[model samples]
Target: TQPIIVTTTTAPQQGGSGSGQQGGNGSGSGQQGGAQDLKEVLNSKVSKWGDANGDGGVDMGDVVLIMQSLANPNKYSLKDAGAFNADVSEAGGGITANDALTIQKYLLGSVTKLPESYAENIKTVTAPATTTRATTTTAKPTTTTKATTKAPSQASGQKFSVKNGQNQFKGDSDGYSYEIWLDQTGGSGSMTLGNGGTFDTEWSAQVSKGNFLARRGMDFDRTKKATDVGKITLDYAADYSASSQGNSRLCVYGWMTDPLVEYYIIEDWVNWCPQPQGGSKTVTIDGAQYEIFTLDHYGPTILDNQSRNFKQYFSVRKSKRTSGSITVSDHFKAWADAGWNIGNLTEVALNVEGWESSGKANVSKLTIDVSGGGQGGNTQQGGNTQQGGNTQQGGAQVQAGKKLCAISFDDGASAQSTSDPGYRIINALAENNMTATFFNVGSWIKTEQQIKYEYQKGMEVANHTQTHPHLGQLGSGQVRSEWEQCNSKLKSIIGAEPSHLMRLPYLESNGTVQSALYDVPLISCAIDTKDWNNASTNDIVNTIKQAAQNGSLEGAIVLCHENYATTAAAMEQVLPWLAQNGYQNVNISDMAKAHGKTLAGGQVHTRA
Candidate 1:
């Protein structure tokens, strides 16, 4: 599907909880099909238009599908034909949260029937649920009269509650050092530091505001530069539940000497992130994009209670994730590239900070390490950075003698919304512990986050073309440009272009196309499920089942499109059936690798 791009403007301003970031929400006119008359769209009697899940009714489940699709288009999307019915808010407008809201209003009796332009009048409608994040412009207090530094307590569970002032503790556990700090103003909060990288914090929402920062990592002596502090990487997993009125941030927090700089490599946050003045600029680091912002703070600091000013440098992630590996030095390099000064490192640690919010967070796993030189720089803690044991596209070890099949999708990346087919397909594959290759069209690609999401989910992200043109009819130069541009975009997200495979648009290729992509292996399917033609889900499923029954499924590539709802539905049945019948679903590259076949470029790979 070709997504409609909407352009919006952003005004520079100070940090506050208004609209955090300004960009197209991926909802616009001219999607799925061109603009249609509102009356004709609403009066259609062919299908249950609003039934997102095809359950014969439009209900909360439909609303939920839309919401989940918006939040995570890769996993829960409405690529089915019913998506047309889901686009109710605006005639010919793509399926968006506005459509979800329209359905919600109908169910709530706010509207008797879905309106043609409900999106334009949704200004006063309060969302059923909302998360209130901290909008306070005040800086967190860094100095307290109750500051204390102590060795690791022999006791395992150490807890403290602060009502009005400040309490800070420094200790070491499991060969790693940690610090817990809390300061409240007209409020109260509590924190419990467990062994190693495990801790929990709860703050009072009844009062006005409070602050908490828990750190686990090396603390410098304000003598060495940030680069000299060594390679810093943090892996953490936590469950953070917050009230709607405050803010929560998970980051690599540190202070610097000489320049009096406070730096934050914010990996994730709750609603309303700190925007800083003059807005922010985008930068790519660690194979993902981040927004760089600088804010000035005037107040007491960690070193003293005297009023002083300092600059806060931030590397906020564009795609926020709760649990992941953070290469802290990548941000350091990015900041330096942006002409930001790197001062003497005073402290560097994995920190969880909450302000003016009544909520709780339980960190089940966390690890922070510094290599070159710094405090808490020990290597006693086992280096277990694997995230829940899921592997990347080529990282998974194939079991010997396992029946392997490749399921490939074309015409992606989908827009970041509920109707996105890529997300839905990715989620389904993940649920079954399988993976596939997404042959994404360059023009259809939306965000770098989408490509990153695919790779992060252990799926192969490949190139279809820049414009889905007939590569077989184009010159070699034109053909090269198509795949080259798409490869470049994918590289920006996943750190490398697709190495093992490329699929021609509509499988239409010739000598020119082959010559242009001579160094990139081409993938051909052994089985075709023509769900893109609006084939019934059962028919698509049967096509694959017949292939397996004929003993031609092993080491075969099963072709389909994630952009079709019918294809997604067929996969729901096909994946489990494949698994149950002793077939392992994998991407083309992995399938080849599993069979010990050398996937040389310039040759078409029809099977493992």
Candidate 2:
């Protein structure tokens, strides 16, 4: 069977008296004529950036139009001319928040002109040049390079399969099931669901009630909160065809309970009922972009379930895609940010809804990789755990005799630290392909970009209190604020929260401090370089060299700081020497893993 092809284009209106152009909403007596006029204006080649209302002007009205379109895409679409004018940023192709900010800056006199590379609304024509003797010359054999195309894999039955006949439902592999409910009284067509977990099935159906559905996917425990789920991913490919009077859609259905709400990620839709609400926010997940739409008070489930006040968030692709993977967790985050109190995730299903349509969809691949907190699961636990049956005050005990050493830097994200000495230390570690743990002081993090660069380059960013105070001397509340504030700042800077590891300032901690930090493990140095005492380069190198010679470097946590020029100079020699002398440099978590230990709060890990 041939694949279904979908096209989107605005048709010209018939019998329009005049171009009754209207802005904001695409509603007017001559809506199609307005579109036609906009296309003509674009063809005339005289529009500038930020002219979203298509009135040939760059002003606040244009900004308002763009904002309104973004807030409600269904009511107002950029379509063509508006899209071309509103896209003024370096992003080049999309009308996004960045473009809106650029327009605002221009209005505020922050810029003189828009981006030079912005596409102009001009249609250039090249007249064919007249050639005299070229036609007489023998035309050499033209070389055509045929584009290579990969054939889709044939569907195979492992645990799930589908076919045409009366509606049926069955269970499949990996705790998944397939269900097809069709109202045959309205229409007729062949429906077959096939493929292992790697692909989707081809489905065709006709119905008047708009109730034909073919579902294939798994259901998770709905009682677990969204925070507990780590990652959910779906990769699929779909094709649809209709008889001009038919309608169909391919969507991923996730049913959540407690409040009984449904979440749908629609891959494609054609002439479906209950038109989507306006306003769309774009998000990139798993390298694919999706336009998210939210609808509230949509009323009872599509399956005619009990009527309950429910909300729905649909993440639809900007364009129909044949194959792409989406990280479902990110969408959940976006919904939550929009004030949707998402309860525990219950069911994750990928299916198609059709009305008088015929076609097929292949899942190709689908995966739900859930990690972190869940129902009855502890969210404060770190990723690494201790080996053996030994239980320490924090969590587990580290075994001895592991040839691993953790190199840590402390108190040094300030401008002074990131200057010559800091770059020197960072360069030395990068050149040596060594990984180090940085316990950063929150207030000292002046160069956030540089710190994020280090994180991207494989260095671990842990917590060192905000003010580097003596935690044992501070009150319990102050201690908690110090750590929590530092963590919050780190997350804002690097988009990650270091909930697993932290080191107290001046290595100061007591029962109160430990009690306050019961979630993050306390990391103390097994070998203190004493570089903060203004130790000379030679002195610092000798301190570590002596430790290595004494065999105390095994499974050792070496503490140093980038704040000192002497420390940076010493590392140039110490790091290479450690590598040559059989000591493997790693982060704290890795060192703990090597020694069969799990890191948790309340316990200090010291080399034995």
Candidate 3:
């Protein structure tokens, strides 16, 4: 049993003792009342999931403590007992900002339970009884240490310090790799790396100065392309302020090798920012609009100090924000669609850069997750990468314990007809509260409205080749052309390709087809309903049921053709049966994520 420790301002009563027990309330009930002079003698127990401050409540105060512990562990680190209590993750890992995020979700009613469901063996105690004398009680308000800590003294012997002239520092900070580059000719710049991927920096005005940038992410040797690294997503939080004069940019900055290009997804800036010129475009990402600018630069880059002609790409946000998530791959796709070439990645980092500006910035949280960029690996630091809340499909939460399966329809022929097989299939799936994927051919989709109707029903539309050619007989160039044509048509209609998935005509994939589309995951199927072979509706239904009886339907990718009326008729019976048996019909992407599997590039996936 764990003893309940209480801090009180008023003196204990002078009688023998008063004993009482109360149910655990997470409303800061352990604190002594300020006006009433009632001492909160906590005689209750709580699980160790979220009570970070040891105050006997899982409330905002606990959340603040967990965040503080991550931001500045030197002074606010939870030691021994507090450390054990702060391990709130369901995985029972060490303390991180994710633990605090989980507690915040719970306090905000986003989650009903903490990761740990077991009750702690906390012991409770009673206080001494009433005294006759009047006592003044002063309540101590919970305070969280701010992220902006003063610059460390030289005696601390931490790492890099602000100085004049060019200085580049590289090492690990709070379990994350970081690099700091200061090119100040006369100004002053200070940097301090903190716990759990946090950084604090300050700078003074300087003339004839380059720029100061502190970053946390990859500083590669220009050997790997962005695709070689996989999909990169960044989650960041910071407090940024700068003077009106001089230029400053808070962004995700990187460089490319072969093309010798530089890029910036500028989230916030001070005073002025780069603007899009002629032939430039705009793309919306993470709920904000950004103007894409392409221009030439003839100067030294991070990779090469010699003068060279290169390109600089900018996705400067029209409006600014200090905290949010960025799906970096979406920007890559948008740039690629606009006929701009991106090359081998040299650096991908969250940068706080100032050009002769005087200001301070504190990045309290930073996390980058790179997964499924054909590298077939996942890297996460300083946080939990799993998305918060239950697994979601079609924007609705899937109930716990239900098995998930992806149902796909192929060959989108005559999808615009009112009697279109896709319409019936979509209606049937919707009636049963499910969704499926439709592999569409470019030419067979008669109108954009046909694709829009499918999307309106929460159905995913994927690529099935432009003309549905036999892919095994095609050369690598031909296969790529087919894929590109289909994707181009889909993007023009839907504003984006359906997913990173493509199905071959007749499922006739060979080495050439695989080699040509090495960056896309070819989706195959485990169960073929064969509804397109003039099979009766009962035959299609029984094929699926037999697979379920054999225990092969769980997490399986089931295939059917969208050109057949019999397939739609069969799904009327098949979808309801699956739902009744505790199975959820999801698209391929959702099923892959649900089963802890990644649909990596250059691979063929039959089941999740």
Candidate 1 lDDT over residue span 478-568, tens digit each: 8889878987777776875454367756655444565466456666555667776667999999988887897767767777887777888
The reply for model 1, stretches above 4 Å from the true place, is 1-396
Worst-scoring 10-residue span by lDDT in model 2: 133-142
TM-score of 2: 0.37
Error of 2 at 322 (Å): 49
Can you write out model 3's per-residue Cα lDDT over 1-608, one digit (the tens) per residue? 01111122222212221222112111122244442222122212223656664433455445544554454332233422344465555222345566676676775578787663321322222221111101101111101111122233221223344443324444433334455556636576666766545677777654666567676654332324555556777788989988776778889987765566888989999988887666778788878898887988786554212356889988988889999998876787778778888775545568888887778888887766655542211221111111111111242334457777777888774566767777888788778777677788987777688677766666666788899887878888999999889878876776644655786576555556765775566777656776756779999989888877767677777878877778888888889998888887867765654453445333445665
Runs with alpha carbons beyond 4 Å of true place in candidate 2: 1-402, 416-419
Give per-residue lDDT, candidate 2, residue 36.
42
Q: Report lDDT per candidate.
A: 0.59, 0.54, 0.59
Error of 2 at 466 (Å): 0.8
Worst 10 residues of 1 by lDDT: 130-139
Sort the predicted structures by TM-score, highest score first: 3, 2, 1
Per-residue C-alpha lDDT of model 2 across residues 115-183, encoded as one tens digit per residue: 423333322111111111000000011101110111223324322222222232222333243444545
Judging by TM-score, tell me the better candidate of 1 and 3. 3
Clashes of each: 6, 17, 2
Candidate 3 lDDT = 0.59
Work out candidate 3's RMSD over C-alphas: 20.1
